[model samples]
Target: MRIQEPYTSERVVLRHQGRDRTFVVVTPLELPEQPPALLYFHGSLQNGNVARNFTGRIFDDMVARTGAVLVYPDGVDRHFNDTRLRLLEKTRELDIDDVGFTRAIVDWLADNRGVDTSRIHACGYSNGGQMVMRLLHDAPGLLAGAATFAATMPAADNRVEGLGTVSVPTPFLAMHGTADRIVKYDGGVAGLDAAHSRGVLVSALESARYFATANGLGDPDHETVHGPEGVTVDSWSREGLPTVELWSIDGMGHVVPTPKQLPASIGPGTDSVVASDVLARFFGWA
Candidate 1:
């Protein structure tokens, strides 16, 4: 598939909760009358621009192929106010309404860009992934589908009040590396230090099961597929459609899975599968 450059890109500012919030919108050259939309959330200490480059602009290819508008919303203080109970002092004190911010973005896209609000999907990495979980829990019907990378659902004791109580039946996809030290793949306390530590979490597979159960899918049918590099796929289906799926990349770490080069400090990644391509396929945009 040939990759196309975004036709136009701009930062959009909005007022919510008596504060100004901003997000980046990238439009495809050939846009549909009512295009499906994608909202991507960046990891901790990163902004929309950083995520755009770090992900190798692969999402732009999805935009090119599917005529979908891509959005990247900036988090408050470069960090999202996720569902974790133990949060940074500043983040806890501010208590930013991120879910409200997301709703505002969705509304803005529908009103200004002619986006299909019912088909909007979300994808996030690391800290951003936790935020996605918050969306899935707090704002159940907002997203059609959700994908998370290098993050898991927080353990019951470490979660905020009312989280994990209401579950949306939206299709869910999760990708995690077994070797991730920051958010341990095997589960337990996350982060290497107090500043970075978000909270405790369930195992990666358990995280997948959590969504599957919430989606009312039966036991998963597991399979090991051979790609560029090895990846283990576990899927839960209902009526022949996979409602929940997990990709466990062996020997990988905190970074997103892509053939493109990434900073080594984040830890090992795989060239076996492009993260965006998998997400596009899973979200039925491919």
Candidate 2:
């Protein structure tokens, strides 16, 4: 069956930490029995609604194919309280409890949406990707798996509190573009300019290695394969299923890898791999 529009979409509001937190939930027209949930966080300067359109609504297709629930969470002031110690000042000063907010959403899903909480997964892009990293470190057991696009782990010295403390192994995937200037693929200080610069980050490979090591996978078997549209796939895995995987696309930029055109300021994208499709397969939704 193909995905159809007019899926059950709702805006939910919940009170947390003396503030109103909101998210958008998109479910299939015909709900599956205890469907898995996917929480997607948006990048800086964008809200949940923009995130939905930014990715070309590929996730809606995932919802149709897998019978999974899709969630788009709004950040406080269009920014998540991610682990970047130097970049976001407003959320830092307010000390927004994004982690708690996420947990609250997960609980709500289980209670009202008939979701399988244990099967819940998370993914994000750019700043949102950093938020997902926060989840991996602060609440390792909260998610079954996680994926990040156009993001890498903050350097140890640049990380916020509670980072590097948790070593629980969870399946992790990271996709980065070699040509990205905002979040340098090889790692280092990131930003479009001094004003927007976030902070230092480890290389994308190092980011993958950090998780792989935490998973107790000593060394990853590496393989490089040619992908469509001048994209190359470099993966590190143990056994058939990759506990930690990294896809490094050549000439792609900070945007999610999709055929859909994005603003030129963010740089080029690829037609080779649609990020939502890759994410769906990674989470076993497809």
> What TM-score would you give candidate 1 relative to the actual structure?
0.94
What does candidate 1's lDDT look like per residue over 1-286, in tens digits? 9764556789999999898899999998889998999999999889898898888888877787888899999998888888788767455578888999999999999999999999889999998998899999999888999999999998889997666554568889999988898898999989867677778999998999888888777664444355445788877876854478889888888988866788777788887788888998898888
Model 1 misplaced stretches (Cα beyond 4 Å)? 1-4, 220-228, 240-242
Q: Could you tell me every candidate's TM-score relative to the true structure?
A: 0.94, 0.94
- Point out the worst 10-residue segment of candidate 2 by lDDT: 233-242
lDDT of model 1, residue 220: 46
Candidate 2 lDDT (Cα, whole model)?
0.86
Q: Which stretches of candidate 2 lie over 4 Å from their true place?
A: 1-6, 239-242
lDDT, each prediction: 0.85, 0.86
lDDT of model 2 at position 212: 76
